[model samples]
Target: MALRACGLIIFRRHLIPKMDNTAVEFLLLQASDGIHHWTPPKGHVEPGESDLDTALRETQEEAGIEAGQLTIIEGFRRELNYVAWEKPKTVIYWLAEVKDYDVEVRLSPEHQAYRWLGLDEACQLAQFKDLKAVLQEGHQFLCSTAP
Candidate 1:
């Protein structure tokens, strides 16, 4: 079976009049292992855990962002498939917005560093094609849905 994991693509928007999605920034965590790849916080789903629950749990564990700290944006979810460690892996992601623009990101031992970046830099650091695509999609989605 393919390894299944879920995570949130957490973002925050700067508060300013006349600002666009350009004010938005995404949170990425650098893994402590394996080429030190940077991606949103995620982890394998445990037995009996729902996909969304796993996503929330992993975000809290890896990024120290509690569920209460962000609002999960509806209507924006992406799934990516790839090979990792000689095994197929499926990762599901959902968009979320931090309630506070300056919310703290406390990284766990699983991750060595974290950054909040705009779309371009996030995509560059993402490196993987699929992840870059998802970040772009998420950015567009936010832009289109901005209030």
Candidate 2:
């Protein structure tokens, strides 16, 4: 069976535009182990947990962002499948917006660092094609739906 995981693609919109750029920024965390790759907060699904539940739980554990602090965007879930460590891996992600842009991020020991980046920088940092595509799609979705 493929290893299944779920996570949130958490982002925030700046109330005041910074440098006249798009007010959106995405949150990314750099892992402490393996290749030290950067990704959104995610973890393996525990027994009997729904994908959304696992995404919320992992977001809280990995990024210290509680469920109540985020607004999960409808119609923007994504899934990616790939090989890792000679095994198949599948990851599910949902788009979520931080209710407060200033909410503190307390990283767990799994991550060595965290960054909030704009779309271009985020896509560059993401490194993986699938992840970059997800970010792009999420960004477009938010832009289209914004007031």
The lDDT values for all models are: 0.94, 0.94
The residue-by-residue lDDT of candidate 2 on 1-147, one tens digit each, is: 999999999999976656754578999999999888889999999999999999999999999999999999999999999998899999999999999989999999999999999999999989799999999999999999988
TM-score of predicted model 2?
Answer: 0.94
Candidate RMSDs in Å, in order, are: 1.5, 1.6
Candidate 1, residues 37-105, lDDT tens digits: the string is 999999999999999999999999998889999899999989999998899999999999999888888
Residue 93, model 1: Cα distance from true site in angstroms? 0.1
Clashing pairs in 2: none
Clashing pairs in 1: none
